[model samples]
Target chain A: MKNNVKKLSDYIDRLNWEKAPGAAECGELENLYAAVRRVKSLKPPVMPGADFPDKVVQSLARGIKRAKSRKRLLKSAAAAAAVLAVALLVYFAALKDTNIVSAMERAYGRVSAYHGTLEVVFTSGAGERQVQSVLDVWADKQGRYAIGVLEGAYQGLMTVSDGEKVWQSPPGEGALMPVFSETHEFIFELGGEIEALKAAQSARVAGEETVAGRPAYVLEVTPQGGLPYKLWVDKETKIPLQKEGAMHNAIQYTTRYIEITFAESIPDELIQVEGKNFREADIGEEESPAPAGESPDEAFEPQVRVEVDMQAEQAQQIAADSGSSPWRLDPVFTAQVFVSLQISPEGITGEYPVDYEDFTIARTDGRRMKVQVSSDKTEIKAVYLERLVRQDETGIWTVVGYDISR
Target chain B: MNEEGLKFAAEVCRQTWEPLYRYVYHKVQNREEAEDITQETYIRSLAYPKFREIGRAEYLAFFKAVAANLVKDRWRRNKKRGIQVGFDAAANLAFTEDPAEAVGERMLVEQALKTLSAEQRKVVELRIIRGYSVSETARMMGLKAGHVRVLQYRALKNLAVILSKEETSHEE
Candidate 1:
């Protein structure tokens, strides 16, 4: 029967040669099972010699060594070129115009306070949507600052710091969450964004252009692994009149800055969030409720539950015993782990020091554990280790998922 | 390269060289080219800065992906050069390289394989040629295990019919 043939075929394909029915038992399907086995056992015309593996290993070793030496040679050549360029710059200091990157850096450094309307247009599904927000930023040389978002989804978001603690109003919520100044200062300043632009792979002045009916210098910048952007700086004041760029490689979506202003000083009332209409909220104690019908005992077991502060060594030991990498214990290094887990870190080089409180370990049924690492504010980086069952031979626990922001 | 990197590269080469060489040899139908491509795959992988960072379990899959990309690039280059590249010609070339009886058997198998759909051929390649478990094949192909089993069963049944017809025609 057709059903018998299908069943016998499945059995043979499963490689249950013993359990698979014999020719007499399979009847008309006998040839099918034999054919399947023959197909499975068919070898390539040419088999690699026994020494192929060693040859491959030696070839790779040599290639890697050559690549390293070539990299060193290029580094030395680049250093020599840099010294010559510096000397040439000094000799032609009076004849040549100032570099656009330095000019832009100087212009932004002189700005103590600025306000602007940021208009961002991005594609969603079939159509486009625009988000317009009024941003007010104030900064001093001591790294003290305040930033206010007056429109868009982050209408109530306000952050103020007095060189110590940062009081931030949560987006869409009228509650002030205080965090360490060192942790949140970068979030409320434009200096960090400017510094990133200054470190772009290439920057050049693309002649003068008229922006908002005023003559401005058009500076084009291309960042590493990012799309290019153009900034129009006012010729008279050297302040940016407008900046625009495609968001990443999305040619259909664009982000632009409009209605910019530079101020001598911001109002004292605008720079402090203490008397603002916001209730204080402590985010450190907040935890999402566990899913219903899920028992903690069934999900995982706490290897070491410490309510008090513990040393880095204890955390490392807990990670090691749980079959997780000890590198997940350090907050700064854990960010790198997250990066490697999600994507390939081929040529990326930088330090990502996440401002966090501590880490907690919980052993799961599988050869993995749950790590709860909290940041300075409401954000908690919950890293869950996934025991790669198929790759258990390697004994590497991959980061299955993490909640870095939420 | 660091010691850990070298150890990892050696382990990967040990596990993957055979399957990778077979895959390339079948496509190119030339031993020398297949060996060159296999060696190049390892060299390119080791030269990558991220190769050492890749998890041990992922090394095989990464090597396969790299090998597949190299094969595709070679095919494109050959096409640009106006080379006569076809499955039948490659299969015939492989068959001619073997003994007389093996030539007949391999030609019959290659002919039967050509009868299957592209998706079915891929399943055969991953499950049979590569000797991957059903679940591993399913994961690689992004299909459910049940679906993969059904595909394999159908593909094998079709191969059986094709081979039977070839034998009958030969007898005639």
Candidate 2:
């Protein structure tokens, strides 16, 4: 364990951005590379619960709260000045580089719906071999879309959003999994780049090219203090046809619409898996939430409630001679964690390791107390001890939560 | 910044919150930390000189860079993407909007995962993706802990080989 900590610290200190080295440069540290990559967001994406956004909002408020009141006072006083600043910004932004950008933005924005295939090709150093991935994409004005993997290891994987819900089917045979609204990550706001380009200090029409059988104008744009990128826009329609550039580290790739067709309307079937059954998202379904707020659909509250005997000794109040937790109330708890909270009626057995990051509460009967899991059981994430041992809320401690990260 | 500028900045932060949080979440692999970093990314970006003048792409790039810096800070964090374009190969792609790159990277990795053997793939999923302890993974896989370690090393080696062959990522 000490060596692991030392290894991690050494690995971290070795990561020098001044050198801007890739994980490939970790040398013989393959284990570190793999671990680092996983931590870099490669986990199978989980759908966030319904109240996830609200939780983030609360967190965000907390994060920026220090300066908020001060800013609020100044902002209220500068309201008129801000209006002029916005107008001047608009005027200057409009004047700097208007035609191709504004035109291309208009072109991409005007269409209500379209079908297109994007193929991104990567070339090796020797240029002897090339690998390509193709996506079959369909989207409508109503924000419904379907993305099918046409070529790649995940060739059959499909993600569809039917305006109301997002469903994803893994690479092989499996039922579709619902992506809860809170955790649904991607919003393909098709032409969001155009707006991003509007702030670029430089955007110019460099030349012309033929893309997807249409003549197009190639525009070279450079954002402030940024590298330049080329975008091909159809001459007649102004829609973007291709984007080619080095994203970071100068690794190069070219993405183009190999096949595209404008349409008056896109059908709903194209945006939904009509016959497939979607597995229910487990969050807020049967799983116990944090003990206190205990909402059916939200992890919005930071603390859930747990009941302990207010009059009993602290150790005896938490468990019997061996020790355990309040999650003994549910059967699902057993499925997620190996430790069973119930052993006879004494509460938790010799197995439940409880040192307590959350300690006993000093609050009077019926008030919220702080409760949490010890490090030994980080895997059992969301278990609220339903209605505690003695009901009526007396001696109930709120689950303040823990890192739960191993 | 002026009140209207602050409002506009808030809107930009709001519009890109999902992708921003997702990006940070991937880096830290912890929900609370990701939330803090995501909000910090926006706050830091909003603090940039003349926040009103930057475009959404630039704004996104700035926030992603801040996110990257925050991750590195946890690992080591300052420095925005476009602001400090290194002369090295990695520096060239820093300003391209990051969420697209992120999505593309995920697709590439997922594609590569399909190439590994089932056992190797499962090892990677449980040990790495799921962050299960070695004992837990062994228990779930019905293998001894020693064997689970071997499987993990082999699976990573296989992934490195596959990813290198079809590499398009430009890391910074």
Candidate 3:
């Protein structure tokens, strides 16, 4: 009976209700036309609006905290191996009888927004290292995630992304570094577990087990190209809550969710690391009170003082060889005020004075700068660090970086 | 309610907010009304003398039952607002409003739905009424897509049989 319903469901899904179902279009089950029609007429789920979850919490005001601790709260108190014993209490509570194959699909499908603590134990690939984040990840639909390190060696680091850009706070520094190249290799494994099962030579339910206080189907499968895996899928929600992978006949790693909450449309603010205007940061430039009017442009522009007696020969020598060069440090304009500009023929006010980089040079260089800010490099290896500044959406100076002559 | 009881009630409110709102919204099919009913359900929970005594596990059921009764009251009011009865009057009912026959047909269908086993009923709700795709339903239930389809076919077939039986009984 269960399998019969499953097949009928698959057929209806394939139908997508594009046309009315009848004996002509659908055989044997033509009597339920009204039911199918009503389903088709029904509206899609209207996601709760205006920050629903946050508003509900705010509505509760003074009566949370201590009372909240009473309802299935996973005590995140155990140091290091806390989550080894973590129940993942209510996250996996809904799914009670799910198995391996269905669990993988559930985790892969239908999940657009989620927050969870992922405990990763390296069994072989790196030695014995266990990392369990008390507060781990909250990913929006865009896969822009905020990976938090709350109770580990990386106690205060947070990495957030806005699809096109990533923001990371250096451990203990609490400063937002604009972008970094961090591939969530573990997350790839989480989503990839499904594809692995699909590409597997054979997969079978090894047994039934309880993982994190939820009944789960234990699956043993060997993929076509990758490592063999043992997966625990929650019976109710079917979300793959825990994974144990093997290499060379030994357990290599296990990634388990200590707890998780799936919500409708996590706020954009979750992934926003604010006010990181890289151009405004004083790099190596020494900015002091301008002594006097040392420039011709000082009248219109605020008291321009060029106290820099930079080696002029070095700038000339650096620009000579690099054809249509983008990397130019006019010591005069940059020494006191390293203000970024669009540098057009009409030359915007606070630009690098004179033919710093002609359009031919600027265009060539601008494209490169645009690419770097968008690149996932953890650190920029540049003698001139001002290239890190990405312009605001409306600004003409969206890219401002150049490769040094060195 | 004492301070501790109020605190527990507040905690339950926080924990079950999303699911509670979804249930009300599903029943009312109106965002504004669902929100109002959801708020009202919580308000009643906080005000009820025995709210402090309700077990943590019973919070969801208690709230849902309250929402269900509220929905029934709403249906009664709409009936009072002149949903025309009798074949002659119902024949002329507007396209937007359900006719008297349609309401009877729905009641029959609802009775047929109740005859299904829990698993069968869930399949009908997720696949038929809720209109989740088989794949999506399969994912939610942690069942094979094939299994979901099979469940829906039997559930509907059973509904058709039960609905047919209801019609015969009404005629008799």
Candidate 4:
């Protein structure tokens, strides 16, 4: 009789799912629809080395120090590791048969936004690095609204999200450089929603586990999306403890929230800050200063800056060819100084038709200077020898080096 | 793996390896890159002495955070060089069979998910696909178990409504 009931329930479940258009499409459902897909091919566990003992001792020492210094008054003089150990021990000891999933949900429902300095260490394929941030995270009563200010290694970046829109300055301002999504919420929650990578295509749930001493459900979600992120959620607290993924543009990251505390007393000042334009500051830093008397009109108007560089070999070459020309000056005796003039934005301020081959100067808006030469390695090569000056985006003009063919 | 360490590693690996792979594959859209990152995640986890002490939630959270940062880094480098890597490599490994069907279905689901709130979508994913026990799903989402169940029910109903609308439109 009981088996029949279970069968009926299963049938209903299948029927309900089939009827729901809201269900993943037939094609989508098939991808994730594999029944009883066993998770095998386990990589033999690599044991923590003898170094574990020492590390554990050190961790204990650190924990004690932290407990002593903790201002919250909730933590005891116990080691942080010990605190975690004891919590897990107590949880297991009391409710040996308790349903972990239910306990977790009850605790998670109480979750609220936390604000504090969360020292985040980021490792990537390139190298292992740390990003220590004093982050201020706030969520509305509904837990949908959130905003944070992260101060890491490079610069301070703000993540303002109304449970929706998020924006930040480029990393030239010393923050995580933007990629894929232009916003923080989009990037952070890729595992949650953004399906461009086809998450459901290759996703599965692993068994139960514990995080931060709280029993947590393990969801092994692999998406057809190129990059996969592992999510470990506390079954008890329903908070995320560790997230491992690609790091540092190239390296992988093993990000863990070591000491997590939820405080109801997060002052408004903690989340609030002076709003300043940081992107502009960074752009200003990269830009060159504008030259004096270089008014916009002067920049637009035509002006001639003639550059003359003496080349003896070129003189000799010109002299060698002079015998074929009507001009009577001995090229060998005359200094073949390569003279080139740059035209301003207005138009050709000046032009010398004689000495140079195909020598021409043209001007265009934004780009004022142009050099033209017909042929002859000597003149063509000589024209490129002089250095050039350009005004950068910051309205500053600075000398730029040029490679001259010898 | 020490008894404790072994259990922790296995649990952590089981919980995360899939999502990490998916997360990396999606962002980098390359299998070898995703695999490399996934393997690297294990290596990094091995380095931490607290691996045994780590809670599953923290482990997964750390993994996602790391993967997200890596994706950003790769995205930046790729953008600077203006190179586009094909999604074939990652997609191939992700859907061992039926790539087209799998990808199409996932796209549809994700498209629909986007129309919902992030919280709602998360609830749906955890409840519907991963099949987390109600309490467990709530804990992972950091919401009350009741809230998780309530949200799951509502999200599912809404999704059903949406799917029905889509079907009707298609018929038209």
Clashing residue pairs in all predictions, respectively, total 0, 14, 24, 81
Q: Write the per-residue lDDT of candidate 4 for residues B84-168, one digit (tens) a residue.
A: 3222222222222355855554555556666778898887666544534344455467675446655654554455556556557
Report the Cα interface RMSD of each model, rounded to 1 decimal: 16.9, 10.7, 13.8, 19.1
What does candidate 3's lDDT look like per residue over A185-238, in tens digits? Answer: 224234555766777788887889977555687888766645466878776567
In CAPRI terms, model 4 is classed as incorrect
The two-chain DockQ for each candidate, comma-separated, is 0.16, 0.06, 0.09, 0.01
Q: Which lDDT tens digits does candidate 2 get at residues B1-172? A: 4456545655676677787777666665555466666766665555444544555566665667767766665543122233331122222234565568878878888888899899988877776566554544665786855577767666666776777766735441
Backbone clashes in model 1, listed as residue pairs: none
Candidate 2 yields a Cα-based lDDT of 0.51
Instruction: Please name the candidate that would achieve the greatest lDDT relative to the true structure.
Output: 1
lDDT of 3 at A191: 54
Against the hidden reference, what TM-scores do the models get? 0.31, 0.32, 0.31, 0.26
| lDDT (10s digit) by residue, model 1, range A1-406 | 5575456434443432111122324434556555655565475446667887888888878877777776664678777688789989885683256665566678787987665444433332233343323344556645666665543333346666666655666554433222211223322234554675678788767889866334687878777644566766667666665555543212123333434555766667765666665433233432223347867443433332323223543444443333234222222233334543344334222322332224444333324446566645324456655334322212334454555563
lDDT of each: 0.54, 0.51, 0.49, 0.39
True contacts kept of 4: 0.00
True contacts kept of 3: 0.18
Question: Arrange candidates by lDDT, highest first: which order?
Answer: 1, 2, 3, 4
Give the per-residue Cα lDDT of candidate 3 at A398: 16
DockQ of 1: 0.16
Candidate 2's C-alpha runs over 4 A off are A1-31, A34-406, B1-9, B77-94, B97-118, B129-133, B161-172
lDDT of 1 by residue, B1-172 (tens): 7788888778878887886787666544446567877887787766775565566656655665666666656645523444222322222231212357656877888888988999888888776666554544665786755677778777877888888899899889
